[model samples]
Target chain A: MKAGSPIATSSIWPEAPAAPPSGLARSQHKSPGETVAGRSAVTERAGRARTTKRGQPDREPGLKRANFGRGAGLPTLLLLPQVLILVFFFFIPSLRALTQSVLLSDPFGTTVHFVWFDNFKALFASGEYRQSLVTTAWFTVAQNVITLAIAVVLAFATDRVVRARSVYRTLILLPYAIAPAIAGILWAFLFNPVVGPLAHMLHGLGISWDPNRNPNDALWLVIMAASWKHICYDYIFLVVGLLAVPVSLMEAAAVDGAGPVRRFFLIALPMLGPTIFFLAVMNFIYGFFETFAIIDAVTHGGPAGATNILVYKVFVDGFINLDLGSSAAQSVLLMSFALICTLLQFRYFDHKVNYGV
Target chain B: MVERAPILDMICHAILIAGAMLVCVPLYFAFVAGSLTIAEVQKVPLPWLPGDQFLANLQTAWVKADFSRSFLNSIVVALGITAGKIVVSLLSAFAITYFRFRYRMLAFWLIFMSLMLPIEVRIVPTFEAVANAALPLQWLADLLHVADLWKWISGHDVAIALEWNMVNTYPGLILPLIASATATFLFRQFFLTVPDELCEAARLDGASPLRFFWSILLPLSVSNIVALSIILFLFGWNQYLWPLLFTTDKDMATAVIALKNLIPRSDSEPAWNIAMSGALLAMLPPTLVILLLQRWFLKGLVDSSK
Candidate 1:
């Protein structure tokens, strides 16, 4: 089981060694059962170490004699706080969402009925919910694609610059520190229909750009804000990814008469495939769930619910509208979506690690 | 270094400069607007340069938004979450890596599974849980029919009601956000890299697990802890949704959430200058942290993602 699992193999911490010496003067006492357990643990560590060595070459030499084979009481006590928090906040809430999705309860919860699948049925039957699904797909895809494209170009350029590279990186990465809500407000201010210089400039250019009245404009506004905030994140990853490309490979390509553009496209770009893939997954998750604040601040899912992505819809329904059952059902769906993304990421990470990307 | 093409280098510099300008323009615009008077900001073509009313507008924004209180709230909440997450994650990571214990993998996998459930997905249920931190216990007791058993035995009505609402409190704003799988994984990764010989040497010297962890492992992990702390601090500072829902009281609002309140809701022309000033002020702390510790911030960002 340990040999085949990617998670197990990735953790290079060696198994417990034959019961290590206890506190002062306790080292001499060893029962028969303790010796037996210690021997088995040693053999187990040896077997796991052999497997781990195949995947991670940087395995610590101390893997042979590490972990304290003390009683479980201390470790359990240390882990209790995190475990309790995770249970109360994460696991229990997730399970509650799942259960509540199939149950019909008023906001007060004084009366309840177990109406299995009815909430999900109502959610699917609603036109607005379906539209939210479509809007979410568009918003997520556009935000990620645009953000990644710009980040890739900017990061590539930053990588090639001989001077002030750090300056450019700092400037480009400035937006990452701005919260999504602030980013929304900043962009919304820039594109404010009244008193906005950019809006005035657009009007001068013969474009009718009013996000308040136009659904498309609102959607685009949210997308632009989300992408702006995300670009810095993507840029950071891409810059590191570009920098990690071995210099020798680029030098080899240059020696073969490949121009800068040609070298970038054929060599650096291909090497960045895994990083780009990882960023795509991260950006997708960002757009899907984390853009709620941006939407709330900028468009409020406005103008006709054009910007009402599923996450925001969940918020409005669950909190504002107090439709508990339907919101819980939507939450379940969103959780499943997150699960799929996580699974996809793990699979990609496993492949990347195994193939030494 | 590959090839000296001055023109190409200049072009790359130009594109980079242009891209940087594009990224910075909104922030620049925010500053410009914040500096202008309301009348000036309302002009057909807003001023491109900073005006002398900057301090005045900033004062107005500060007073109107009550940023003094909100800023304090934000600082407290951000610090609380960052400290809580780092401490818990460090302890858990140390436990998982240094000690052999039963159900260890079970605990590890449980934390790993949390990566799937971000607070956004289970917002409502999580809110309900937060509203009554003991809701689950109450439900469990109800499921076991404990109240019914008590009533039957004592010939009296009984109720198992436990209430501990977290809303409008510091813990409400911070605790739920502190259970970070990313931070835990980051510390775990760092711990795995610690040479095992150190653990062996400490043990042979008759030191306890916690002693070795404090004397050696904790000191070695300073850099990782610093990097992770910066990331978590920014994360805590930038939080919007959780704080928005958790804190209904005006005094409890974070600076980020309070900035939104500055935007006028009525049809009356909004105070663009004042609102933008608040936005700029709200963004100052995390931006300063990032700018000052760019190296650690970058390291933490890249390392945590991995």
Candidate 2:
């Protein structure tokens, strides 16, 4: 009934140009005679606005905005099952990990002592943990830089194509679906010294490349493997980013005597700032967490612990060695790092990304 | 596309094709190794071309190693997780979108917080939860003193071991992985984009909420649902760590987990071809899914990230 009425009409017209009711008007805006449904619906849309409460129009600086529902009981009931599951499986376990981080537990988990912050102190003091940190830092840097560079180059190439672009995209992205474990195995097989083709090529080139015995070789191999799967993801995003760049802007730049290379560096690169930032954080997180399977399947964290990333070490300490305290501590640290990245990504990037040209 | 440069276009295709080849090198080796004889694979610099023993290797992996069973196990586990996540998130997304409940943001934040606590970070407690499924129930019983009431009624002492061990079970494999915040978030975003008028129209038609959900919301979100399914299927099918931790029994192992086990542990005379065959088997399902649902899978990835 309220669908086309003046007040209800403005709620649905996402592109309605009327300025949101400011200060005095917000108080007077809710019509006393508005039907219950219309009032609630209007309030829901108003509630989504940045500056105000239920009955006021949102002044958010965007063309698209989500309309939230405003009812009671049934909606709450509908959400309960998922909330229960998440609370049970996710929140409780994470809270347990947080509490466990503060307490020191024995191998069998029978006896526990509340030793607050000692586990964290021990982690900071440990040489192995420190080395893992260094390794993780370097790994994150190398993997993301290489992955982004390759992806940007390839995405630029793919974006330039006027024919069969999807074919190239499909082929490149096939690796994205392959599990990291499988990717690890495949890459490890390629570098397998005995019958591996890449190993044979290295041998033919007189480099004496043996990943099993060489720490640096093992590290680079794992990095390449991890980066291999990720290039597809970054490439897809970059292609999307490149496609989103306005042709008029580039054409205008071209007419201004900018070369193709200059056009890319000056115009396209800056325009893709948000995409690049998003991919950086994602690639870094991927290196930190998701590379565990890759490292496990490929190097098993070593030719002398060379490839043991922080995530792999966490798994080793927790599941393999049963060091609950240290593992829990490591997990807490990992969680903090992830949370920071996620928060930073949202705080600085989301608004910019949404306000796309 | 803005410029017409023939030479640059040739260079671009050349570079892309080369990169594609590099990406496929490992896969090609795996395929070749899967097809070759063990003796041939053992030869220095294994043959790059496919051999005629493909059927033999597949037969060996399937019949002798019981990979077919593991493959079926993976399918069941993947499908189970996908369906459970979809159902759970669908209900929550529906409720959160349509209802104005107290502490609604609290419920939303609680689900959102789970995105940070990935399974890897809380593997230990999660393991304990699954292993001692009755632990929480026991705590509840203790809190509520149900044991006292039971003893008073029965007039005999009873032990509530309630050893609800889920190790090596289908539900165990699926349940822990199903409470995904990402899926819920994606669904909520999609549902939010849906015009509120649809709901109002349904309400005016005297349609019950369930009827509206079944006939209207579900039908409207088919594309989103399909895309999410494709992505979730790959995720479930490709799980390695959880399956490895839980499924100690070879018969209960997922194809990916069992494939890792198939690698010859012995230092002397490894069966490289068999291992390749196992890898090939492990990759087949998800690879086929991605290839077939490439469009939906890509769309889902972009949408979820957004």
Candidate 3:
């Protein structure tokens, strides 16, 4: 379904006399002939007149305006707890990180000195930091591509099967419930060089598989684990998106002599563009941030830091090495990444109504 | 059928079955490893079948990792976060939707800004804030010179520092993590769909805002609440990085973090059976929640993402 799609008023409030002729509700009841630009001026007076005549005849017309609760005092009081939390936890810490990015402080915080741009400059100067930027880019792209490709295939396949659709869905979605750390652990166990069956099989096939010493193997291990956990999430959204595709379109395509594969590639896949884009943005964020637990569990950014994505480096620098300035700088960079992703998502969501069938 | 493509259908089933199997293999392997003895687990080919040492391995892992304490801590933290988020989000959402207040949109936007600052992005500063929970208040007091005023009035210097460190505590674990923009937005969306007539009728009956909310809105939101709670509980339980960094005390560790402790530090071969058993145990609660409340879980997932 499209974002901000109107909910059916009758289904939610069965006892209500009729739909409340308010702003949002009025917009939901437009006729086919009415233009969206002309809706507000036409519906506003009509809705007020209709509602006043049909219900609440005793109430003053001045009070007929929307929003039943009056004044700001009680509402302000109700909002205090959550606002305080946002201030203390989210706003304060984010601001603190921003300020800390410009200052160098001792581990114990007993001494501090302002070093504006030095942390960022040093980060950009270091080959390891530059390598980490490249590493994070590669990791995010590889994991996202692999996960999305598999999820799209599985979701479309599940839609084609009529016998036990939900059974396959539930089975595939089981991984979403597992913690990323546990997923990493399970995969690590399966690929452990000494005792792992999969590793043994790979060795039997003459592939040298050693995650402990091989940087490429270590990166691949984390990538596989992260993708394994992420596929379920993408599959759920893709399945919903696929289900929303019209069967009539498929039938019409079939009537035109299109094969099932051709019909899917031409019709269903195009209809899923918005959903795929949404999933891509989500997967970008997941790969950037949420896969820290997987990397920590599976590779710990090991084998000479080959798997040290940016988020893991932030943790290692801040916690392990106690380089607060550098880590805060990295946090600032990651915050910008989050902001960019969020902006992209909101922009896409704003245009989704136009994209819908 | 439009085309009755049995061959296509068979191919689809084959793809689905293979995908499902691929998704489930790691978990099945974990189970198999957990059921084996240490030596059997270390075998080159590894026993594909279950051995008789499952309970023994589970007990060893449980005792070694101190899961009894960690699981209790996880339960408390997860429940605290779930309840805290629901209460906070419900109140804020109700206020935003029902009341026409000045700066109401401003407040909503301010909370919305938190979507950009996830725990991962602000790890160090959040940790510092939690370590000294009163830091913000202390800063305010310092800026306003409260301590100086008190010292001048009493002719004695008074240390006005407030130490309410939340590290390794339940509030530390739950409160910082409870300001959820998604949950707030979900409740807001649901609240918007509610007919305005209901609120008008409640107001006409002389019911106050809180009374209307408690008596009318809350009951209607049961399904939404349950769905959101299922999602929030799973989110809280599956938390790893936050708990790993915040809770240094072994007694305060979560079950997910405790799974890390089962990994061997020495050069000696790690105990695969025990670690796998711990991993299985660590994932059980959320897994059961997903399986038992699959409908609500999916509903919450889809709704919150929206």
The lDDT values for all models are 0.80, 0.74, 0.80
Model 1 alpha-carbon miss at residue A190, Å: 0.5
Ranking by lDDT: 1, 3, 2
Encode model 3's per-residue lDDT on A1-357: one tens digit a residue.
111221112122233212222111121312111111111111122233434544765532212234654688888888998999999989999999999999999998899999989999999999999999988998999999999999988987986777888789889999888889999999898988888889888999999999988998988989999999999988877776555455566778888999988977898787667668778999999999999999888888988989999999999999999999999999999999999998877665544232231
| Candidate 2 residue lDDT tens string, B78-103 | 99988998988888877666665566
lDDT, candidate 1, at A207: 96
TM-scores of the models, in the given order?
0.90, 0.88, 0.90
> Model 2: residues >4 Å from true position, as ranges?
A1-55, A58-72, A353-357, B143-160, B266-268
Q: Write the per-residue lDDT of candidate 2 for residues A145-226, one digit (tens) a residue.
A: 9999999889888867657777787889888778889888888888887777888899999988888999889988999999
lDDT of 3 by residue, B57-121 (tens): 89999998999999999999999999999999999988877776677778878877898988998
Give the clash count for each candidate.
0, 1, 0
CA shift at A17, candidate 3, in angstroms?
27
Candidate 1 vs candidate 2: the DockQ winner is 1
Which model, 2 or 3, shows the larger lDDT?
3
Candidate of highest DockQ: 3
Give model 1's DockQ, 2 decimals: 0.49
The parts of candidate 3 lying over 4 Å away from their true place are: A1-3, A6-65, A352-357
Per-candidate DockQ vs. reference: 0.49, 0.43, 0.55
> Cα deviation in Å at residue B47, candidate 3?
1.9
Model 1 spans > 4 angstroms off: A1-51, A54-65, A352-357, B148-157
List fnat, each candidate.
Answer: 0.72, 0.52, 0.65
